[model samples]
Target chain A: MRLYFEKRKTASKKTLVIVPAVSLVISLILTGFLLLAFGVSPLQTFAAMFRGAFGSSRNFAETLVKAVPLMLTGLGVSIAFRLRFWNIGAEGQLVLGGVAATWTALFASPYIPSFLLLPAVLLSGALAGAAWAGVPALLKTRLQVDETLTTLMLNYVAILIAEGLFYGAWRDPGGMGFPGTARFPQAAWLPRLYGRVHYGLIFALILAVVLWFFIYRTKWGFELHMIGKNRTAAHYLGVNIKRTILISILISGAFSGLAGATEVAGLARRLQEGLIQGYGYTAIIVAWMAQLNPFASLLAAVLMAALLVGGDQVQMMMRLPAAVGLVMQGMILFPLLAGSLFSEYRLRVSQPHKEETS
Target chain B: MILLVQSVIAITIRAGTSLVYATIGEIYTERSGILNLGLEGMMLMGAVTAFAVAFHTGSLVLSLLIAMGMGMVLSAVHAFLCITMRANQVVSGLSITLFGTGMASFLGQRLGPAENNFYLVGLTAARFRRIAVPFLSDIPILGALFYQDILTYGMYILIPLAWFYMFKTKHGLNLRSVGESPQTADAMGISVTKIRYLYTILGGMFVSLGGAHLSLSYTPGWTENITGGRGWIVIALVIFSMWNPARAIYGALLFGGINAIQFRLQIAGAAIPAPVLNMFPYLATIAVLVLVTWWESKGKKRLGAPAALAVSYMREDK
Candidate 1:
C-alpha cells in the first residue's frame, strides 16, 4: 500500500509538471516556425535575442524596467478577472492616468515641495484612472450597460483625450512646439535603483505581494471571490454586489493608473502622446495565462517582459519587424487557452449517435 | 448653418458606411448564438487584404471580393475554435483580434508607409460619383439624402432585406431559435451546429463589407489602425438597436452625426476643449446604453439579451 501511494503521488506530480512544460515547448516550436517564415535562423535569432535581453547589465536593467508596467497592468487585469469583471480598458485608464500625472506635475510645480509633489502626482494619477473607470462602472451598475463594450469603447475616447491634450493645450512652449508636455521637474522623477532601473519595479513587487495577501488571505478578498464565483448566491449571503464590483474595478483601475504614473515618473519623466505601448492590452493575456492568480501573474509578467526585450533584439539583429514579437505573443495565448481547456474538460471520442443507440 | 447641415449629412453617410455592415454582421452572428468579439479583427483583416490586393492588382472590384474571402477565412478560424472545439467564445475572439491586428500591422510596416494607388485602370474618380434623381435632388434638406454612392444605396436596400430575412424566413427563425436556446433548437429538429456555422461565415462576409467600405469607398487609402474603434462602436450600436437592422441604420447615423459634429466643432474652434468635444461620441454611447437599459428594464418587462447568447453549447447526454 505504501508503494502504491508513492507511485500515485509521483504520477500526479509528473502530470502537473509535464503539462505546462509541454505547452512551453510547443509554443517555442511555433515561435521557431514564425522565425523561419521571417527568413531568419530560429536558433540563432533566439540566441541573439537571449543575449541582447540579458547579455549585459544594461540589458538586464532594461528588462526589469519594461517589466514594471507589465507587472502592474497584469495585476490590474488579474484582480478584476478574479472578481469576474472583465476590465479590458486598462490601456485607456493608463493613458488617462498618465495625463493626470502630467497635469499634476505641471500645475503643482511652483507651490508644492519636491518631496510632497511626487506622491501627490501619483495619487492624482490613481484618482484619474479610477474616475475614468468609474464611468463604465456607473453605467454597468445603474443602467445595466455591458462593461465589456463600454470599457472597450472608452479606450478610443481616452486615446483621443490624450492626443487632444498633447496636440492642443499641453504642447510644450520652449520645446519647439512638440506635441508633448514639458519635461517633468526633478522632484517629479521616481527614485532609481542603482541609478539605472527605476523604483517602479519595487512598487510593482510590493503591490503584487499586497495583492497576493488580499486575494488569498483577507475577508474582503473572500467576499470578492464569493461574488465572483456566483453573484446571486453572494447577494443572498448579504454581500453587496454593486459595491464589491465598484471597489474591485476601482482597485484594478488604480493599479493601472499607478503603472502609468510610474512610466511618467520613472521612465518618460513627462507625458507624451504615445506613453503607453499597449501594456494594458498585453496584460490581458498575462493575467489569463496565469489563471488570474497574483503570484502566477508576477512570473507571467517577467516572461512577457523577456519577450518584449527579445523582440527588440529580433528587430535590430535579424532585421525582423518588432511585430513578430506580437505574433508570437498572440500565438502563445491560443495554445495557452487550449491548455486551460483541458483543465476544465476531458476529451473523449465517440461513435455517431445512431450507432451508439443501436 | 448650411455647411453644418451638409457636413452632418456627409458624415452620417460616411460613418454609416462601416457601422451598417458591422451591425448587420453582428446581428447575423448573435442571432446564431455566437457573440463574435473578433469582428474588429476580421475587419482589420478585411482592410489589409483589400488594400494589399487592390494596391497590387489595381482592381477595385477584385479587391472587395478578396476582402470578403479574407474575412471568411479569418472568421472561419473563430468558428473552428468556438464551434468545433467549443472553446470560450470571448477568449477566442480576443485572440483573433490580437493576431489579426499584429499580423496586419506587421505586413503594413513591411509594405512601407506610402499610400498605394488603388484606382481602376480605365475608370477615374468620377466612376464612384454620387447619383441623384432629378425630383428628389430638388427637394430641400432631403435633396442631400437623394445623392449617395453605390455602396450607400446597397446598405439602404440591405437594411430592409436583413429585417425581412431575419424575421420572415425559416432559416432566420431557426437561427433565432438557436440563439434563444440551442438545446431547444436541437430538440426541434434544427441543426444548431450547422446554423451557427453558416450564420457565422455569412456574418464575417458582411463585416468584410464594412472593411472594404473603409478602404474602397470611405477612407480611400490604407492607414495603420484605420478602422479605429468603430468596430466596438458597432457592437454597442447592435445592443442599442435591440438587434434590429432598421434601428441599427438610425443608430449608425446618430453615431455618425456625433462624429461629424465633433470634427466640425474642432474646425469651428468651439470654446470647449477639443478633448471634451472629441469625447462626445463615446459619452453619447454611454448615455444611450444607460437609457436603453433603463428603458428596457422598466415595468418589469425586461428586454434582456437572448438567454443563451455567449454561452457555449455542450451536447451532453442527460
Candidate 2:
C-alpha cells in the first residue's frame, strides 16, 4: 500500500512536468511559424532578437527595466490568483496608483525632503491601488457581484478617469499645451543604478523574495491556499474566507500600485496618459503560466519581458507593427490551455467483459 | 419642457436599445447555463463586420447577415472550449474575448476608418419608420412611444416569445432542466451538450444583432468600442432583473435612461468631469449587483443560479 501511494505521487508529478514541457515545445514551433510568416529566417531572427535585447550592457539594462514592472505585476497577480479572486483589473489598479503617486509628486514635492517624498509617493500610490481594488473586493464579498466582470469593466473607467485628469485638470502649463503633468521634481525621482533603470529593481526583487517566503513558509499562506483550493472546506475549518479574499486582493492591488509608482519615479517621472506599458495585463499570463509560484513568476516575467523587448527590435528592424508580439503572447496561452488537457484524464485500453463469459 | 420631454424619449430609447438586444441574447445563453463573457468582444466583432461588409458591398442586409454569422462562429469557439474540452468557463470566456478583440482590432485597422452616416447608413439597423396609430401617436404623454424603430417593436414581441418558450414549451423545460441540474437531465435522456451548444450559438446571433444596432442604428455609423461595456452591463442586468426577460427589459431601459441623462447633463454644463459621468453605467451596475445580492441573500432559500451554470459535463464517464 505504501509503495502504491508513492507510485501515485510520482505519476502525478510526471504528468505536471510533461504538460509544461510539451507546451514549451509547441510554443517554439509556433514562434518559428510566425517568423516564417514574416519572411524572416527563424534562426537569424531569433539570434538578432537575443542580440538586440541582451548582447550588450545597454540592451541588458533595458531588459531589466522592462522586467521590473512585470515582476511587480506578476507578484500582485500571483497573490490575488492564489486566493482564487481572479482580479483582472490590475491594469486599472496600477494606473490608479500611478495617478495617486503623480498627484502626490505634483503637490508634495517641495514640501518634503527627497528621502521622505520618494517613500511618500510610493506609499500613496500603493494605497490608491489598494483602495481602488478594495471597492470591487468589498462588493464581491458583501454583495456577491462577480469580481471578474466588475474588475474588467472598471478598467475602462480607470483609463477614462486618468485621461480626463491629464487632459483637463493636470495639463502642464510650463511646456507646450500637451496634456501631461509637470515633469516630476528631481527630489521626487528614484535614485538610479544605471542609465534610466533605477533602484526599483531592488524593490521588485525584494518583494519576490518576501512573497516566496510568505506563500511557502507562513500560516496565513496555508490558509489562503486552502481557501483557494476549496472555499467550503476553508469555511468549515472556521476560516474567514471573505476577509482573506479581500486582504488578498488588497495586497495584490498594492503590489501592482508599487509597479506604477516605480514607473513614474524611475522612468517617466510624470503622470501621462498610458503611463503603464500593459505590464499588469501581461502579468496575468506570467502568473498563470508560472503556476503562481513566486520564484517561477520572476522567471516567467523575465521571459515575457524579453519577448516584448525583442518584439520592439524586430518591429523597428522589419517595419512590422508591434502586434506580432501579441500573436506570440496569444500563442503561448493557446498551448498553455492545450497543455492542461493532460492533467485531468489519461487514455486507457479497456477489454470486453463479455470475453470472459464467452 | 417640450424639448426636454422629446429629448428624454429619444435618449431613453437610444440608450436602452443596444442593451435590450444584448440582454435578450444573454438571457438565452445563461438560461442554458453557459456564461458567454465574450459578449462584448463578439458585439465588437459584429459591429466591425457589419461596417466592413457594408463598406465593401454597399448592401446593408448582407452586412448584418455577415455580422450575425461572425457572432455564431465566435460563440462556437467558446462552446467548444467550455463544452468539449471542459476548460474553465471563466478562462475560456476570457480567452475568447482576448482573441476576438485582437482579431477585430487587427481587422478594423486593416479596413481603415470610414465615414459613418446616421440616416442612410444602416438598413439592417435603420430606424423603423413610425406608424402613427390614430390615437396613440397623438396622446400627449404616450405619444413619444409611437415613434420607436422596428427593433423596439421586435423587443416587445420577444418578451412574450421568451416567456412562452421557457415556461410553456417542452424544449424549454428540457433546457431549463439541463441548466438546473444537468445530471438529472442527462439521466432523463436529454442531450446536455447539444442544448447548451445550440442555445449559445443562437444567443450569440442575437447579440451580434445588438452589435449591428450599434453601427447601423444607434449612432448610425461605426465607432470603436461602440458597445462600450454594455455587454458586461447586460450580465449584471440579468441578475438585477432576477433572470426574467420582461424585468430585464425594464432594467436595461433604466440603464439607458441614466446613460442619456449623463450625456444631456454634460451638454447642459454640469460641473462633474465627463469621465466621471461616463462611469455612471459601471457604477450603477455595481450598485445593482450589491442590492440584488443583499436582497436575495436575505431569503432562507438562496436565490442560487442554475446549478449547472459554468460547470462542464462529460458523458463518457457516466
Candidate 3:
C-alpha cells in the first residue's frame, strides 16, 4: 500500500484548537527523554517548573510580568503576519522601543509636563518601533527587497545601537562602570497594581481587545485578511496592497514598541543588560501557537512566559540549565507544524498500482 | 600603506573562508527550492560541538564530523516538515533555527568538563593553524591565499567546483529544474523530493563546516553566540552572489574586508565607536540587497533564483 493525501473540502477548525494542545503534550514527552538522558526525572522537573511558575502568588505575578511583553509583541507580530509580511525584526523593534523610551524619560521629561511624562515616553517608543519596521516595508514595496533578510539583519543592528548607548553615551555614571543607563525619574516609573506587576498588563489586555476588534470587526481587517490569503486577488480587486502593508506593519511595530516601553518603564527601570531577554523571539512562537489570533496569542503568551519564568526557577532550584525551558518552548512548534497537515489534508492508504506494461 | 593593504587582504581571505562555505551551502539549498534560515543556530551548534569534542578528544576530524552530523539531523527535520508534511516553508525554517539555537545553547552549558563549571565558555581546544605555501607566500597580494588554514584552502577548490557543478552539469540542471518547477521536473523523470532532500542535507553539512571553521580556525574558542550574525550575513551573500558559488568570493571579500578594517581602526583608536563601525556590514548588506533586487526587477525574468522556491510540490496541485 502507498500513502497519499487528499485536500480537505474545508480546513478543519477543530484541528486549529486540537493541534496546539496535542503539540504541547508531545513536547512534554519529547522533553522527558531529554531530561532523562541528563539524569533528571521528567516528572519531578516538570513539577518543579509548574511550581516555579504558579506555585505562589509571587511567582505567578512574575509570570504575568513576562507574559505582558510576550503578549504585546505577539499582537505586534500577528498584524504583520496577517498581511503575510515576515517581520522578524520584532526583537530589534522592541529593543529600539526600550532605547527610545529611555531617551524620552531622560531628555524629554524635562520639556514635558509631569503628567505627560509616561505618555510621551511610551509614545516615542511606539513611534520608534513603527519607524524601524517601516524600513523593510518600504524596501519590500519600493525596491522588492526580500524582507526576511532585511528584518533579521536589522535585529543585530538594533541590539548594537542599544549596546552603544548604555555602554557609552548613556552609561550610569553613579553606578560605577555598570553597562546601563541611569534609573528613570519617578514620573516615568510605571505604577504597579501588585507585587512587581505594573500597568503594562492592563495595556496589553486592552490592546488585545482593541486589536481583536480592529482585525475581525472592521473593513480594514477584511483588507488584511484578503491580502494575506491571496495578494494577487487582493491586488486585482483594488485593495491597494502596498499602502495596506505599510500601515499594518507600522501598527505592528508600534504594538511591539509599546511592549518595550512598558518593559523599560515598569520592570527594568532603565535600559540595561537583561532588558532583551528574548521575549521578542518568544512572541513568534506565541503568535503561531495562537494561530495568529490576537485573543489566543494573549493566552499563548502566558503559557510561553510560564516556560521562561519556570525555566529560571529550575535554574535556581534544581541547578538545571535555564535553557531547558527554551528547549521546551522550541520543541512545541515542531509537532505543531507537522500536525498542521492534518487540518488541511486527509491521509489515505492507496492500493499499489500494477506495474505499467508496454 | 602597502603593508596595511597586504594585512587587510590576508584578513579578508581568512574571514572569507567561512562565508564562502556558508554562501555556497545556502546557494545549493535554495537552488533545490528549500530555504533554511537555521544557519545561525546550526553554526552555533557546530561551533560549540566542535570545540567541546576537540577539547576532550583532541581529535579534529572526529569533532568536525560530529558537528556536521548535528547540522544534518536538524536540516533533515526541516526537510521532513516542509517536504513530506507540506508545512509552511518559512515557518518551518524559523522553527528549525529556534530549536537548533536552544539546543546549542543548552549543549554549550551542559557539555563541558566539571572543572570549568560545566560551561564551554572560556575553555581552550584544538584549533586549525595556518599553513603557509612556500613560494606562493612570497607574493605581494595574492600571498594572502597561501597563508591559510586547510579549510580556507578547501574553499579555493570548492568555489570553482560548485560553480561548474551547478551550471555546466546535467545533475545541476536536474537540481535547478527541481527548484524552478518541481512538477515539470517530476514529469521529466526526476524525483523532486529526493533532489531537495539530498541538497538540503548536503548543504547543511557545509554550513556546519563554516561554523566549524569559526571555532577551529578563526576564533578558536566557544562563546555564547560565536557566529555573532555571520550566519545571517551569509544569507545576504547568497543574494549578492546571485546564487552563484564563483561570484560569492567577492561578496565575502567585501564583508571580510570590513572586519579587517574595523579591527585595524579599533587598534588605531579611531574616533568612531566600535559598535557603530560594526553596523557597516549589516547596512552594507541591506544596501546590496536593494541594489540587486532593483537590478533584477528591471530585467524580464529569471534573474537567478529558482522560480518555484519555497513552494512545495504535491503533484496534485496542477
Q: Provide all candidates' interface root-mean-square deviations.
A: 2.2, 2.7, 1.6
Worst 10 residues of 3 chain A by lDDT: A349-358
Q: Residues A1-358, candidate 1, lDDT per residue (tens digit)?
A: 0110011212233333354556667767987886677556888877877876777888877778877888888999788887777788989888888989888898776888878999988898888888878888877877777787788778878888888878778878776866788889988988899545788888888998999899889988988889888888998999988988888898899888888888888887878855758788878877877777777788878777777787788778867666666666767766666655455455554456534542
DockQ of 2: 0.28
Model 1, B44-121: lDDT tens per residue?
Answer: 778777776776677778777888887788778778778766666777778777777776666665543334322212
lDDT of 3 by residue, B160-182 (tens): 99999999999999999998889
Q: What is the lDDT of residue A297 in candidate 3?
A: 96
**Which residue runs of candidate 2 sit more than 4 Å off their true CA positions?**
A1-11, A14-67, A139-146, A153-157, A173-175, A191-199, A232-243, A276-279, A302-321, A349-358, B111-153, B219-226, B300-304, B314-318
Q: Give the CA lDDT, 0 to 100, for residue B229 in model 3.
A: 78
Candidate 1 matches the true fold with a TM-score of: 0.87
**Candidate 1 DockQ category?**
acceptable
Most accurate candidate by TM-score: 3
Model 2, residue B222: C-alpha shift (Å): 4.8
Residue A239 accuracy (lDDT) in model 2: 91
Worst-scoring 10-residue span by lDDT in model 2 chain A: A1-10
Tell me which of candidates 2 and 3 scores higher on lDDT: 3
lDDT of model 2, residue A299: 82
Q: Work out how many backbone clashes candidate 2 has.
A: 0
* Error of model 1, residue A99, in angstroms: 2.6
User: Which residue pairs in candidate 1 collide?
Assistant: none
